[model samples]
Target: MTTASPAPELSLRDKPGFSDLQGVTVEHGLNTQDMVVNIGPQHPSTHGVLRLVTTINGEIVKDMEPVIGYLHRSKEKMAEGRSYFQYQPTIDRVEYLSSFYDHYVYVTAIEALADLKVPKRVEYIRMICMELNRITSHLLWFGTFLLDLGATSPFFYAFREREAIFKLFEDITGARMMYNYFRFGGVNADAPPGWLDDVRKVINELPFRFDEYEAIANKNPIVMDRCIGVGVTSYQDLLDYGVTGPSMRACGVAQDMRKTNPYSCYNEVEFDVPTATEGDVYARYKVRMAEMRESIRIVHQLLDNMPGGDSAELRKLEKEHAKVAEEIAAAKKRVTVAKKNEEAPNAADVAKMAEKAPELPFDYRTTGQKVNLMVFKPPAGEAFSMVESPRGMLGCYLVSDGTPKAYRVKWRGASFSNLTILPSMMIGNLYPDLMAIFGSLDIILPEVDR
Candidate 1:
């Protein structure tokens, strides 16, 4: 019983296996102890529901881990039950900010499967709308980034121009934010008559509007101090993390999906991929601003050389097909009545009329269908498609099981990869500098968690 007092009764708190404070420790050699903090799922600067668990040694972040999944919507699972046509609308939810680009990728994949050929005029229209959407997305990013850095007025100014672009989309697609416009063979509808003129007016006003925004935010000393030389992402880091779009261009990489991959008539357009050597927050900002200007230039060119044709030819084709079907039904009904009245035509008479029936010509070479509008079954294979979304390279890897729905769908979101490098940038930075780095990444949580 005396046995050294049974080693002080071996309290549960002292045992390694049972102790609640198993890994807790205090620094012995450091001048000041580090503190653990959470930046938040509620912090406005985080852009969405994101929590950063960080350890700070004074103002410098010693370690950080990002906690996500709060905005998860199970979009891929939702796509499984939807028909190919039905799923087109769901793409708008993947990256809510750049809904058109998301729709473009999904529609393009279906187009490839169905072997649909889009008209040249339709291609040009798609390019115009996509470029405009690109500019709008960039505008929102610029405004929000500036807001995170404590600037207020630029957000309003950027949104004013962004709203004009949204109105144009709404005019054509009939939906402002999430436009389920792009279809398997073509767009939902043709652009309105005065839409091109409205585009030109916005393009004309943008240069003056951009100049005003630049004066307010780009040249300000505070903005320069907060952004320049801060959150530097090296060219190699960008490549390693698979960053694209403005973020990669900011690091001096000239990889633009619109240029390299060249989808939706992007190759026909002439525009520069703006780049910067610094790879800092300011460089990303500069690249985005320059991109908006390039978008404006492309819009101007598109307006000047906008193709003129029966804009609603596709819709007309659908209507004509419907009419022909109705006529055929009527003829069948008449034949049935003639038989009932004992005046039915003989085989020779029926043959003569069949010979005279005009053949309905449908361009099915591109769309892989004999009829212009028909439910299609994609081949049992997989395809990967990428687009230059405002954030970065948005890619969709889809597998079809010879069914109406996709067997598997994987979204390679650029925001998810871009945000992975944030901790490295914030490692030795001050508290406020965190906002600058986070803002520059331009991450949308829905895109990541989708």
Candidate 2:
């Protein structure tokens, strides 16, 4: 709980990799002029539709400015126009790769405002989904980052693992990407039968999968030559720019919200916050790789110690189970009599009768308390909920005027803040190093513009 001393004010000369270039001027002959080149409004390495306006003097970037908003969807404004339930689905677009983090912040904000007490099982479910999402986001970053550095096979390898986790997500949330699963008090539904066992199986295999990824790109010459010592940033720079998540941890900050703030079930889990002192592209890459392993460790703890069933909804369903089971047995006996009476029962008829059977409730409940989401309105107040997303600290500020729709909804995206330090990082570097620097930051544009 002790606070660290404030960072000292640093000059441009104090910046790593920029010190030698401070007083030195690039000498391009009269034949060569400072040329302005546009990297992209459409390019692969940008990670999205983003343009970097760069002034290069003979392959040396003299200046660079990120031109954003090409992918703007006015997500904050849409929250105002739509009801709380209506706006929940759109929350996925804020940060699609790790949308669970987005949903967690939004849902928790309302949960806090309304004073909803989430059950232990519900908290465990949210924690599992969010940690799995962290792995998938980092997997995509690992693959795409290596691809940016001129390696292709790792991209496919990364997706192979990512898709496996997504399949588990699909089994639970019924969607692969934009899973609007997390709700105000709980989740949309309970985990399907045998789903927890399936999750354990997939996560068990992930450590081996991570080893395969590291084997490919860890010591590769192309990766090292492009990433190491490139886009070097200091701790002061990270603090000044409001950089967070793995990018901030790379600068040796260890400022993860999960560890420091401890929302949801994060306080109960045991895991280390991965950090590196180099504060370069390679450092960021290394931090994210280590974080994925920590996420697996967190998942292992959550699954092993998950709370057993105490869902009120399940209790209610259990009360009606005996009657429903009796009715199903009577219906099956009628079907048996019909077969004896020389009436042919088709597969469709048998399936229709089978639908009446009572299903076994999930071992762990997905919901804590039930609320009619279509007309949910919290008391007049403001609450800011934050979570350690795959990228950085993702926060949602909600102001409720005792209405179903929020009075104000604002997002503090880590990408937007992380992207601010890019121009400063690229100013003294070579033109080709842009991909290495930007890719390492993992700037997803939808979250940036949202």
lDDT of each: 0.79, 0.86
Clashes (candidate 2):
0
lDDT of 2 by residue, 1-450 (tens): 388888877665444434244334324212345789988999989989999999997788889999999989999999998888899999999899999999999999999999987877888988999999999999999989988888999999999999999999999999999999988888898777677788899999999988988888889888888888988999998889988888889988889888898888788889999999999998999999999999999999988887763234455676688677776666666665655556645546666766856764343456666789999899999999898899888899999999889889999998999899899988978999999898988989999999
TM-score leader: 2
Q: In model 2, where do residues sit more than 4 Å from their true spots?
A: 1-31, 309-364
Across residues 1-450, which tens digit of lDDT does each residue of candidate 1 receive? 556554456554444434244334333322444688998889988878999999886777878999999989888888788777777777888888888888777777766765677755666677788889988888998899999988898899899999998998889889888998876766666687677777888889998998898888888999999999998878888777766778789988889887887887677779898999899999999999999999888878777765553335444655676676676655666675765546655556555655666432332112223333336678788878888888888888888888877887888888988888888778878867998888888899999888
User: What lDDT does model 2 reach?
Assistant: 0.86
Give the 10-residue window scoring lowest on summed lDDT in candidate 1.
Answer: 360-369
Worst 10 residues of 2 by lDDT: 22-31
Instruction: Give the TM-score comparing model 2 with the true structure, all chains together.
Output: 0.83
Candidate 1: TM-score?
Answer: 0.81
Clashing pairs in 1: 114-367, 115-366, 115-367, 116-366, 116-367, 117-366
lDDT of residue 299 for candidate 1: 77
